[model samples]
Target: MLSRLTQRLTRGSGELREAAAAAGELGPRAVSLVPALRAALGGPDGGTTTPDLDADTAVAEALWRIGQDPGPVVAALDSVFVRAAQNPWGRWAGVRAARAAALLGPAGRPLTPRLHPLLGDPEQVPAAALALVAVADPASLDRTALAEAVLDAARREADPMGALRALEALGAGALSPAHRRSLAALADGDARVVRSGVEDRIIRGDETFRNRARALL
Candidate 1:
């Protein structure tokens, strides 16, 4: 299975993505596939940053999950963050890298500088905030400000899940008085929170998110 996935990692982008995900699920057992995953990020040396941001993120994440080595994996993930920041269309890769960092827990601490500025980016804020909470030292981060950014993201971002996840990471104790008030309103079914003219599925999803947020309170 590892050999087949390794082969797929060198194939087209679609296969590479699927293979990377599959290898990640294999965890440390798939350590043998690490070199192939690295090569998928760029050339045989795996030092050349690839233009394909999504593939780079996937391969980096797979390498991290495999857990044989972290030095190159951290470098690769950092490359994704840097490249994605430079490319307007690469926003999703930034999101994925932030998420992958969160998955790495304390080992992801090296990416803190890259993650901090992302809090100002509406598209990247939630994921970046979540990653920071996972990787940053509490003494170094202002939890109130992080909650405020997440609250803003939850209110205005197209997808609220990341914001919600970040908020959960911050937890109820971290919320300021104003933050709780705003979240209470959202939980109570503020029309703005649900939005209008969207499908019922979206409305319901928003409601579900509201309940989950409320649970955090």
Candidate 2:
């Protein structure tokens, strides 16, 4: 399986990349594919998909699944994120990078500052929020401020699900009656908002974050 995925990543075709991504979705069992996934994130070929960002995100997701040590993956992704952020060319690569950084969890703690501001990014707010959830120290997180930023994202049509999931992540201590009302309002307004309620179970982004809003908000 690892060999096949690696070959597909190297081949740079959509079908090959999809096959590789399916194997990667298998999680830690696919740990050996980490090196190949890393290469695909930025290699000259790098499984360049229609947007290129798609492949970057796919490889990053696989690394997040199996990666235990933040050592190299974090640094590499930060490099790509920094470069993409400095320029306007990257579609949503920076957002995906932050998400990958979140996947690193504790090791990714150092990247919180960079990830937080992007919660406002219209292009990929949900992914940015996901990153924050994965890396927040909880004790140190400014829940009030985080809530404000995330609520703004949820209001937008682009990726409301991201904010919905982020809302589920907050604890009762962080939410006031108004905040809860705001969430309930979102729940009532859009059925797609409830999409987060269902897909949250798959651990699409993080199992720990699954169904957070559905249960909490």
TM-score of each: 0.89, 0.70
Q: Write the per-residue lDDT of candidate 2 for residues 2-109, one digit (tens) a residue.
A: 777777875355654485467557888887877667666653333222346555555656666676666555655555565566556564677667666766777787
Q: What would the per-residue lDDT of candidate 1 be over residues 1-217, giving only the tens digit for each residue?
A: 9778866888455678778989988999998887788777752233323346667777878888788366776787787777776776767778888898887778878989989878777878889889999988878988899888888877884358778788888877779899999888777754746464559877788778877877877
Question: What is candidate 1's CA lDDT for residue 32?
Answer: 88
lDDT of 2: 0.62
Candidate 2 worst ten-residue window by lDDT: 202-211
Worst 10 residues of 1 by lDDT: 42-51
What does candidate 2 score on TM? Answer: 0.70
Deviation of model 2 at 203, angstroms: 24
Model 2, residue pairs in steric clash: 168-212, 168-213
Name the candidate that leads on TM-score. 1
Question: Candidate 2: which stretches are off by over 4 Å?
Answer: 11-20, 43-50, 86-91, 189-215
> Residue pairs in steric clash, candidate 1?
none
Give Cα distance to truth, residue 110, candidate 2, Å.
Answer: 2.7
